[model samples]
Target: MQRRTRQQLRISLLIVAIAAGLGAVFGLAIAGAGDGDGETRAYARAALRGVWTGGLIAGLLTAWEYIYVNRPAGLWVRRLTFLGNVGVRSLIYLAAIMLSIWSGATVFSIEGADPFGWNAQTVIQVGFSVLFSIGVNFAMAINGLLGQAVFLNFLTGRYHRPVVENRVLLFADLVGSTAIAERIGDLGFHGFLNDVYRDLSAPVIELGGVIHKYVGDEMIVSWPDTAAGRSRALQCGIEFHALLAAAEARYKNTHGAAPALRIGIHAGPVVIGEMGDVRQEIVFLGDAMNTASRLVDMCRTLGRPLLVSEALRDAEPSEDGPALEPMGETGVRGKTRPVAVYAPAP
Candidate 1:
């Protein structure tokens, strides 16, 4: 704010100096008009003085507009836009002042010591008009820009922090990850993991889901509402299945056994927020996430790559997702009632 203010102040002072210079130039031109003859010289001088006085005042008004409009607070001023608004308001004031002066000089013919007479009434009226226009413009401009800035920030990833909400959640982890990492080694393993993330991100993003975080060989993702959220969770399973198949083919040629992965999806609300003080990360909270984690843990028990809840299957069965089969009801640690489980089709 201070920087912007200083910049505006400097510009204003510079304009004032320039206005003074212009006025002086006009005065000199008038003085030199009649080859220094007494009568012609006096008329030239008076005309120069009149024009310079008007020009100086107009220039000052323009300078003020420029300075004020560019200020941070000016965004709220409707009549004033951002920096561009300064120029706009300046032009409006300039035109209005010129019209007022012209009208007074032509109609009233108020003759003073100079050919062009100073009409206090015209100046006052135009001055007020300029002020009124600027004030109104400034207010409108600021209000509109504030909203624009917010959306712009969101679109540009400036406000990347996520909001936590109750919803379905999924946690996918790579099985035999440690063995695979050892085979690929650290550097190559990092690349391999990045490739998996890149491949997985598109489907999630397309379905309006957000990637929560990566936990070593595991990744957690969430969707917005329950239905759409479950859709994304299921879609992720299908995509991950297909993607892993393709990756397996490549791995067979390059290395040995295809790396296996397990995915567990649970439907429920979870608190989401940017976690960690050093590098803020979007994370999930609530039993939903915990349930999802446990479901993935159950993958070891069932010897399956993917498992989902009946709630997810019921939400959108025909939608894009892995072909699933009922796995019967099973008791989970936290819940008293037995939960229905489904295995994702290979």
Candidate 2:
């Protein structure tokens, strides 16, 4: 929640800065149009001031939306159904829009000088401005910072040229998903999985992991080749299961049982490229990913909740968290040489 809060604030500020630049350009053009009052030049020079006058007001209103979205759900918050919550969400948007209009009017009074008088005309103009601002904020809320970056890059074929990156992959799957699904009907089981996945996002985000994809009951999280990512790789996996343990009560209460995570961590080079013809998407391709997936599967047989490859085990770790115990060699399917695995000390 904290990491997401930081991300949301950065994105909000970025969008507001862009909006201010645009407002300044328009203000300058309008100022240049006529032989203006001495104050026109003052306003022109301090365009950012006027823009910020609007931004600070708009930020306070919209920041709440980001908070609620990224918030950790309590038992009561989780219990609210879609219909039960839409009205609340609608009210938030409405309040945000109204506040933005008032701010826009305030911005028109730059440096204690007001050329535009408050009236229905002013209300209508400010209403339009705030509407656009709110719309942009809502879009950001929906797509998230990572999604927006990917979508923007896709337009320019940014990853068209395949590049190899040293990335650590964590393949975490729910243990006994089949049994869980059987206990809960398909529809109920679908909701259960959704809840579990949402829970997983907290630790991943907090630890700087990117959500690669969720394959049914399994979720794939990855990190770049940076030292921060490499060192915290295993710790993130450990903290993820810790998070599940912490949420066990909520899960049990909601579904009559709690699911646990079995994570497999591996590090290696992967070719990052764009894929798909009809609906394009970024793809991370490598045998390292396959090995990571296999390691997680091995967890079911080994009866360990967490497993790590020799590669990840040997890597210089940043945090003095859990110690990895040598688990001996195991024959990995599709590979000739047996791979060494380790389990985190309890």
Would you list the C-alpha lDDT of every candidate in the order shown?
0.64, 0.72
On residues 189-255, what C-alpha lDDT tens digit does candidate 1 reach at each position? 8767766765665556456566666789898777665775776678767677777787787766655
Tens-digit lDDT string for candidate 2 (24-62): 665565445435665655556546544654465456645
RMSD of each: 18.4, 4.3
* Cand. 1 Cα-lDDT: 0.64
Q: Report, for all candidates in order, the number of backbone clashes.
A: 18, 0
RMSD of 2: 4.3
TM-score of 1: 0.50
